[model samples]
Structures are given as C-alpha cells and as structure tokens.
Target: MHIAYFPELALLFADIRFPQDQSPNNASIHLTWRPPHGEAKELDVPLLPDTTSLERIEVTMHSSPTSAYKMGETHNKWLSTCLGYDTVLAYLGENERPVLMSTHQKSNQPQIQQGGGWLSSITSKLPTSLGTIISGDTEPDDKITFADCAPFLVVNEASLHDVSRRLPESEEMDISKFRPNIIVSGAESCWEEDYWSELQTSSGVKLHLVQNCVRCVSLNIDYATGKPGEGESGKVLKKLQSDRRVDKGSKYSPVFGRYAFLGKGDEGKSLAVGDEVTITKRNAERTTFDWPGISSTPLPTAS
Candidate 1:
C-alpha cells in the first residue's frame, strides 16, 4: 500500500501507539477515521492470531521480495469503508522480510578485501553475513517490517534546507514529505551524506549506509486534501530531478536521502530525537548505489 499508486490511502491516519499496560502477548492497534459524509469510526484491531483465515500474498519490490499475510473480510471491510473502495490490509511478521543484502557490510567484500587492514577489521567487527539477506538457502534473523527498501532512511537537515532554498518562495517543503526514519543536523554542506558509508549514534547504535533513496511522485502529494498538488508543490519531484540524480543506480528517480540498516549488536536499540550522530566511516568516492535485485534505467537530462 503506497500513496503513489493509491492516493486515497493518504486520507487514512493510523494511531500506532499502544496502551501503557499493553503487552506483546496481547497487542493491537487502534484506528480512528471519518469517511466523507459518514460518521466517525474507530476499531481496535488485535495483533494476535485470529480465527479468520488469511491469504498469503507475494510482495515484490525493486530492492527485494517478501511475503505478507492479507487480512480477512472483516478487517478488510472496515479499511475499505474508510478508503471508499475495496482493499485489504497486509501484515509482515517479524523476521518475515530480510533487509537488502546490499545494505549489509558483508555485501562489500571486494572493497574490504582490496582495502585490507583497517577497513576489513572494522567490518569484521560487524555482524556475520546473513547469506543473501533475503530468501535464500539460509534464513536471516535481521529483518525489517514493511519498508520500501532498507530498514531506515536517513536525511540531512542541511540537505533539506538546501532543497527549500531551491524551491519558489511561495512553495514550502516539509521534512515529513520525505518520510525519513532519521534526520541528522549540523552537516557542513548539502548532499554530504552521499559519501557517508556508516554512522554511529551517541548511544552506540550504528547504521550501515547503503544507497540513495529514489524520489517519486508521492512527494507532490498534499496530505490535507489527499491529492496531488497543482502548484509548485506538484513540481517538487521535477525540481529535485534537475540535479539530485547523482546515483548511477535508479538514475531515473531523484535521490534525496540515504537508505540504511542497523549494524551488529544494535538490534532492538532505542533511538530518540536530539541524539548526536557521528559519521564513523565515509567513502572516498560517492556510492554508485548498486543492488542485486534492482534494475537501473537512464533518464533524460533536465533541461
């Protein structure tokens, strides 16, 4: 379920907060929304296994492939009514979807071997390789829920500020539109994250920076109206396409943020706002953004 294909989904707001006394043994999410010309509705959906038979569905993406459990008729009916169309909610259980192999330190074996000494030692300290990091002969414990590509998408505040400066004065760009899982500030220049290979937080959580995140038409969506904007807001992607297509992989889409995954021993670690981020490793050259499952296509140069 992506806003680019189903714009109406933007109208639905999910309250992911759990009750203070909620336990993993009994978990659920509460959803509240009011359809157009309809009364407000709310539902507390149980996360535990139910008697309703679920359909297993194959979910394919540019980065990797996975499976999801599609909810039965009752849950689907409630969600469909809110969206004003027939739809189904899918759930990807823990460890169901592995993080992309390209994002793992083990995937850069050739570079580590060539560099030797320090470079190899640093990565050696990281988690052991998880086979292909997807469906392969071995199943991986390091997994993500339902992110598009990587487990985390990190954006630099300075880079976002640069983007705002490029936009027309009448147009405004919000960081929420980019949907980054983490935002780092105090960067000296815009787009400096392109060279970052790894980051460590003040609390010792480390992230292996993988690839540049590709932009899409969803950037032009106006959350207020749940529709694509017709003004400068609609041209946000076009504006980024003018210069942000630096990655050789996925060249057709503009790059704004870096996709990343947690490093060794950082699983289940907690991160909060205002945490200081330190760039632990940086590439001498910008990453070309290559992945095993993704195909790249060239795009016309901006006029």
Candidate 2:
C-alpha cells in the first residue's frame, strides 16, 4: 500500500470531501507532492479530473474513517527515516470493512465534589452507576474517523471564561485549543452540564452527557508554534486541581468540558449557531468536595 503525509487529514478531510449530489468536476483539487523516490521528486496532478477518468480510491474502513490511503515498503522506510519515527502507511482503494459502535459506562461509584463550578458529587468508591457508554470506538456498523472517544464534544462558553479568569491568561490561551463540537452559553451553563445527562435542542436534537473529558498533556501544546511546554496549560491544570477538581470519584483527573453522543432518532438534523438550547437536569446532586463558595467558607488543604 502507499500513502501521502497529510497532517490535516485528521481534522480537515471532512471539508474536502467530494460532493454526493452532483458531479464534482469543478470541486477537484490540483495536488502536488514530493515523493520519496528517484529522480522525479515532485509531481503535480489533478485529483478526480473527471467522473469517468478519475482515479478513485476504494477502501473498506473498519477502523479509520477513510480508506483512500496506502503505504508502500519503500515509502514507509523513507518516511520513518525522514520523520525520525517509525510508521507504516497504507491506502484503502475502497472501503471493504465498516466501523462499528461500541459501548462505555461511567463508574457507578459514589459521587463527590472537588471544587467550584458544576455540582459534581464525588466519593472514594468504585463506580456503581454502570450505564451503557456508547462511544466512538471502532466497530462494524457505523462510520467513524480517527476520533478518540465520542462523536461530539460539548464545551461551556462560560466555563472557558471561568478557566481563563482563574488562570494566568496567555496569548496562547484560545478556546479553539479545546476544539469543542458544540459551544453552549448560558447562566451557570458549565455547572448545569454536569447534570444535563440528557437534553434536547430547539431543533428537537437530543444530546447525552456521557463522560467528563479528562485533561491531557496535549492541552499544553502551544497552538501558535504547534509545540508543547507552555506553562499556561500547566497553570490552568493546577488551578483545576485546586479549583475545578470537582469529581470526587475521579479527583486525580482534571476535566474541563463534557463528552456527549447523539440521541436516537435525532440524527441528520443540523444544529446551527445561535440556536436556543436548553438542558434539563435529570440527575440532580450536590458536590461533596470541600472548597470555597460551596459552603461560603474556606477549607483546609492537606499538605
């Protein structure tokens, strides 16, 4: 198999897709690339020059979203050397395999609260609330790309502002770094999401809050330079540990936003900007973590 190095495929491929309604002759792209082979280093060619004359890639993607990528032995070897990393590339001419849906479950443990923000109930117990966690895991029925867990990630606009105000603001600190699929803004929206396990949009779209998105080192990457080691991400995380560590069951892991999935029978509808969105609290509980504002008094921290 053979493939090209496209770092944008992870996030940008959705926009470059060939239209399904009509012939995409004008939408075609003239791609030029430098192959890792002989005298012909760079080549320019028209992608999908025409419907009949176009070179189509077919792949049965069971794991990845697209199968139009391939990797050859020589290309693979060259890529590893040039990039200083080991990688194998392959292109699927057509989708022969399909992605399937998998299930996940939140720990059915006693809930406890850590800090200010949402009403997160936490406890030092194993999960006792075992519910089906339908995630974006690889499977055999649905089509999914290289996404990590779920289809959509939900973020609270108010929460982003809250994190910014609490932490040292840096030029690198932009909401795009979090990359949320849906951004919700309202009074106490972030805290309400912790309880918005299931809710509906004005367009009759339904969403389910599944898991609290755990923070990672990747958050530290400086978006401007595309490099890590910015102390901003670290400082925000420390503040979360100090302020946002609200989940008692999972106190160690700092989370900002929530992960969500689409509701059954609500697929295919478009959720646009400025849509009136409302969330209902199906499961209401209070946080037990000792912090200011919750009790209107400061609690002692363990050394």
Candidate 3:
C-alpha cells in the first residue's frame, strides 16, 4: 500500500459530514458485485471492515519525475465511480503539518523505504512529500507514515509455536498471520516479551518495550483465504481468549504481540535482521499480563 497525507486523513476522520445520514460514508462499506452467471447484487448492510481496505489498489507503481503528489480532480471523480460510493480523496500539502512525538522517538514528516527491484539492497531515506520539519530540534527525528497506532510490533518465534500448540487448528497459524515488523527467533521460551523492558543490538541500537498490543477483529482475516474465519463461537479467537487472555481490562481482547518504540538517544541507530541483540533492561513486575509463567527473568538465549 502507498502512503497518503496523514493530516488529510485526520481531517476526514473528524469530518462532521461523515456523521450525517446522507454523507454517504457509512460505518460499513458497500460493495457492488456480480456473480459468475447470476444477477449482480450488493453485500450486507454494514460490512464493518477496517479503513485500510479502502486504499485504492495499485497494480504497479512506476516512478515518474513528475507524478503529482496530490491526485488531480479527475482522478478523485474516477475513484468515486470505481468504488461505487461517494468517496473523496485529498492530499496533505507540504508544510501543512508539524512535527510530533510518538510514545517514543518522534514522528515527523514521512520517511520512506529506498531500494531497487529487490530486498537485500534496500535502504531508507526521508520523503520529500512532506516538506522540511518545522520543529526546533537541530537533527530531525524519525519520519512516520500514517499509522493506526504505535510504530513497531515485535514477535518471538517461540511465542507463535506456543500458541499453535494450544490451538486445535495449528495449520492456520502462520507467522504472517500476526504481521510483525521484527521477529526474534532465539528467545528461551514463549511469551517472554510480557516482561522485557528494553533491548539493545550489538551495535547499540536500543528499543523500549512500551506496552501490550491489543488484538482486534482485524487479526481474524486469513491471509491465505482472504476471508475472516469465525466459528459459531470464533474458535481461533476463543483459543486465544482462553490462554492468551493476559490483558485483564478485556480478557476477550487477547494480546499476542509487544509494541516497542525507539529508546531515547538511539534514534540514529537502525535495527537490522540478525543484529545480535541483547536485553539491556528487564522488568520482573508484571504490568498488564504475565507471560504464562515467565517473571522478572533475564531474556534467555538472547543473541
């Protein structure tokens, strides 16, 4: 998916027009569909899908020296027609937004991935789309695109295996199902992140284990089938609720991943795969949920 101006979205989400009955943007998305050989019809009254699904699909993006950052008026009209609903697209102009702080580090104008046709050669650079940072800080902080919440989600490979062993349908549990940004493989046991406080890489890049990540219906979507699976009582989610219900606030909303942020003074350092990470800090006192039985223990098998 491509990135859009964050401010424009913030405005749209807060727009009063969306609250009106005729405003046309409903809580549920309406899809116009046609069967293989039967009459065309619409789906349910309220689809209740997440907003990410609405971002227009791009078959392939070719770099153009002059591709407009703001989509033209015709393009906006075309999207409305294609989506079969009244939709509006807007662009956040350069210099329209200010630098902001996240739970950690800073979220400024968008920075982006830089690379060629392959993965191994890729790097990152600040995006020119959002103009220079307006903050007084001499050096710029990290650039972030729009996000639903915090920036990074860390996964322990051992944790996935642990969850599978507890579920009846293990085949459906793939690493991709959780969608983690970083996956560490050598943890001593599963669910250890519930107590991890901070970590550093061999190169001294440090990150703080901020808080628990709450699971939502979004996780139920099967990447393999593109269909959200739900038993009569939601078997997969039930299994999570039964054992992974560490968050007492809402035991129904089980958590499986840890949200992390860049530790202070570690902004310039980057985390690469296989960086020989070490647990720079650990906390034994449980906050939200204890990892089954792991408590106050130093991160084991940390590389």
Q: Which pairs in model 3 have colliding backbones?
A: 284-296
Per-residue lDDT tens digits for candidate 1, residues 1-303, read: 789977666666665444578554466777776444457678777765453477788776654558877877777899888887888777765325655445543444333211212211121112123222322211244455576766677888788887888778866587878887678877768898887777776666767776778788999887766788778877889999999888777777788988877676554565666666777777665666655445363322559
Q: Which regions in candidate 3 have their CA more than 4 angstroms from the true location? A: 1-145, 167-172, 230-234, 289-303
**What C-alpha root-mean-square deviation, in Å, does candidate 1 show against the real structure?**
7.6
Write one digit per residue (lDDT tens) for candidate 3, span 94-176: 21221122233223322222222211110122111112222112223433323323345666777888767765653536665
Q: Output the number of the lDDT-best candidate.
A: 1
Assess candidate 3 and give its lDDT. 0.45
lDDT of each: 0.67, 0.46, 0.45
Each model's TM-score, in the order given? 0.78, 0.55, 0.52
Worst 10 residues of 1 by lDDT: 118-127
Error of 3 at 12 (Å): 21
**Candidate scoring better on TM-score of 2 and 3:** 2
Q: TM-score for candidate 3, please give it.
A: 0.52
Residue 186 of model 2 has an lDDT of 67
Q: Which regions of candidate 2 deviate over 4 angstroms?
A: 1-84, 88-145, 169-172, 286-303
- Predictions: Cα RMSD each: 7.6, 12.9, 15.9
- Total backbone collisions for each predicted model: 0, 41, 1
